[model samples]
Target: MSRHGRVLVAMSGGVDSSVAAGLLHEAGYDVVGVTMKTWDYETSLGGSGVSRATSGCCSLDDMNDARAVAVRLGASHTVVDIRAEFGDWVIDRFQADYLAGRTPNPCVLCNTHIKWAALLKRADALGCEHIATGHYARVREHGGRHVVSRGLDAAKDQSYVLWGVAQDHLARTLFPLGGLEKTEIRRLAAEMGFDHVADKKDSYEICFVPNDDYRGFLARRAPAVADLAGGPFVHSETGEVVGRHDGYPFYTVGQRKLGIALGEPAYVVRIEPETNTVVVGPRSALAERTLTASGVVWGKWAGIDGEARLGGRIRHRDPGAPAVVRQLGDDALEAVFETPRTAVAPGQAAVFYDGDDVVAGGWIDRPARAQPEASPEFVALPTL
Candidate 1:
C-alpha cells in the first residue's frame, strides 16, 4: 500500500480512533485528525447543567482529548461543526420513526447519512484522497469493485450498521483497526502512551440522549408523542381486550413485559399506530417467516436477476438466519427465512450477507405475509 497520500482521520477522542490516527502516521501517511461536533451537549441534554464529561461523543471534553492525542502524534487537528446536519438527519428521523410506530436504528442512519458523508466531503476539500475512521469493518477490492466485509473480530464487527454506505464511498474509506482485535487495539494504545483513553468505557447509548432515557427524551423533545391517547392492548388472534397501554410508542414488538397482569405470559405481537392500538399474544405468535424491506442498497455483487440465498439479520445482536432474498424493484426486496424467527420489527434494517461480506441491505418496511401466493418476478437494477 502506498503511504505518501494525505488521509483524513475521523477522531472521536476514543482509543479506537486515536490508535487509527497513530497507526496511519507510523505508516508514513500525512494524517490529519478531525472530530465532528455533532451536537451541543448542554442544549441537547435539556440544559440540565450537567458536566460535559458525562455526556457522550462531541462533548467539549472529547474534543480536548482528541486534540491532545493529535499533539502527541504531531498531526494537525480540527473540529468540524455538524450539529445542524446531525439533528436533521439522525435526531429528527428518530422521533419521526417512533411516532409512526416503528423502532428506529439511528446508528445506521448516522453512519450512512451524517458521519461518512460529512467526512468524505471535508476530506476532498482538504486535498485528502482517503478518509479513515474507527469503525470495526473492512473494505476490500475484488474484481475492480470495492466490498465491505465483517471485521476480523466477530464480536466487534460493525459491518451491520455500515450496509448503507455506498459502494463509491467504500472505495476511498479506510478502517485502520479492521484487521486488529479490540484487545490488540487497546494494547497498542497503551504502548503508545495513550493511557487516558485506553481503558475508557465504550459508549453504548445514543450520543444526544445523555441519560439514555429515550422515552423521556422524546416526550420533552416532541411533546405530541407523549400526548397520544392511551389505547387498548388486544390479542392478535382472538381479538380479545387484554389490557390498556400508556401509549403505542412506549411499547415495541415482541416485548414480554407489557406491565399488565395476565394469567399467562403475553408478548407484544404488533403495534398499530393508526388505530392507536397494541396487539399482544402468546410468545409463539411472534415467530415470523417473511419480511419486506425498502431503501435497498446492494454491495459488491449487484444486479441480482433472480432469488439469491443469503443470511439475514433483523437486529444488531441477532445471529443471522438463512433466507432466500429477491429484489422486488429498484428500492425493495423480500426475505423468506428458512425457519421462523421472532422479534422482527419494522423500521430496523434487514442486512443481507454472503458469508462475511455484506451483499445488500434495506429498511424493514412491514411485516410480510407469511407465505406470498407467488414470488414476485425479479428485476435487475443498475449495478453500484
Candidate 2:
C-alpha cells in the first residue's frame, strides 16, 4: 500500500479502467477517477448535440458509467473537457492525413498529445503523483529508467500505439489491467457490485468514427479536401482503369471493399492524393522488406544509436520481423529488413523494437521501387 502513490485513473466508462480505479482505491492509494471528453464524434455525425455515450468514450453515457463507478467505490470522479485539445491533436491530423491519402494512426497521436499531455497535467494539478489507465500493458523500471512492456494478453497489447511515449510518462503512469486478463477484470467488477460492466463488450472502433465511415466525417471537416475529390483507381501492373472513387482518404491499405473489383482479387497498394489515384495490385506486391520512418520517439532505447537492427511490426497485428534501422537525418530513419513484409502501407506507422522494448518508431513512407535504395535524402521531413 505504501509502495504506491496517489493515482489519477483515466476512466473510459469501460470495465477495464473502472476496475482499475477500484483496485487502486481498494489498495490504499488516494485515487481520483477522471474521464476525458476526448472527441466530438456526435458533432461530426450530425447529431443535434452530444450523442449518448453508451458506447464511446466521453459520451453522456460514459460519463454516467464513470460517475456511477466513482460513487460505488466511494472515490471522487470528474470529467475534464479536452474536446478542443483532442480536436487539434487528433481529429485535425486524422482529417489532414486522409486528405493527403496517407493512412494515419490517430490513437498514437492522441496518446502522445492528449492523454499523457493533457490528462497527465490534470493529474499533477490534482495532487496525484501517478496516473493510471485501462491499458493492457505493463511498465517496468530497470537501471534507473522505465520501460513499457507487453501485458499478459498479447492480443490486446496496446504498447504498439504507445511506443512514442517517454519513460518520464511511464514513471508516472500505471496500468491496472497489466497483470490481470479481461475476464478477471470483469469478475472483479461484478464482485464489487458494478453491473454496468458485468459484460461490456470492448469498444473497438476508432474512438472518433464508431460507425467506421470516415469519408462522411472527412467531407464535413475538410470541405477543401472534398473539393479536391478522388481520381481514378487503376490496376498496378496493367495500369488499366478499373474504377473511380470519391476520396482515397476513405480507404486503407489491404482494403477490399469499396474498391473496384478486378477480375482477380486485388488489394490497395497505394493511394496518391496528389493525382487522386488508388493503385491496385496483387497481394504479392504488398510484400516489403523496408520502410522509411519519421517523427520518431526514443521511448526505451535512448542513448543507443547507429545501425540499430531489431524486429518490427509495421501495423499492430503483424508479427515482428528482423530488420535494421539507420538514421537518415536527425528526425528520420530508413529501415531495411532481412525479409519482405506485405501491405507495408505508406502513412501508417512502422514501430521498431529490441525484443519487447520499443526502440524507436515513425511513419512509413513509400518504399523505393526495384533498387531498394539504402539512402535517399532521408529527406528533411516537411512540417506537419
Candidate maximizing TM-score: 1
lDDT of 1 at 39: 74
Using lDDT as the measure, the top candidate is 1
Off by over 4 Å in 2: 1-3, 47-55, 224-230, 370-384
Weakest ten-residue segment in model 1 by summed lDDT: 375-384
**Which pairs of residues collide in candidate 2?**
53-59, 288-341
On residues 1-384, what C-alpha lDDT tens digit does candidate 2 reach at each position? 435777889988888888888888878888888888877755765642325543355567877888899888878899888888787668777876776667778888777767887767888798889999999888888677787777778778878888777668888888878878877888999998889976877877677764656776776676666655457888888889888877677777777765467766788877766577888878886777767877777666564467877888888787778888888776678888898888876667888777777777777766654222122122221222
Clashing pairs in 1: none
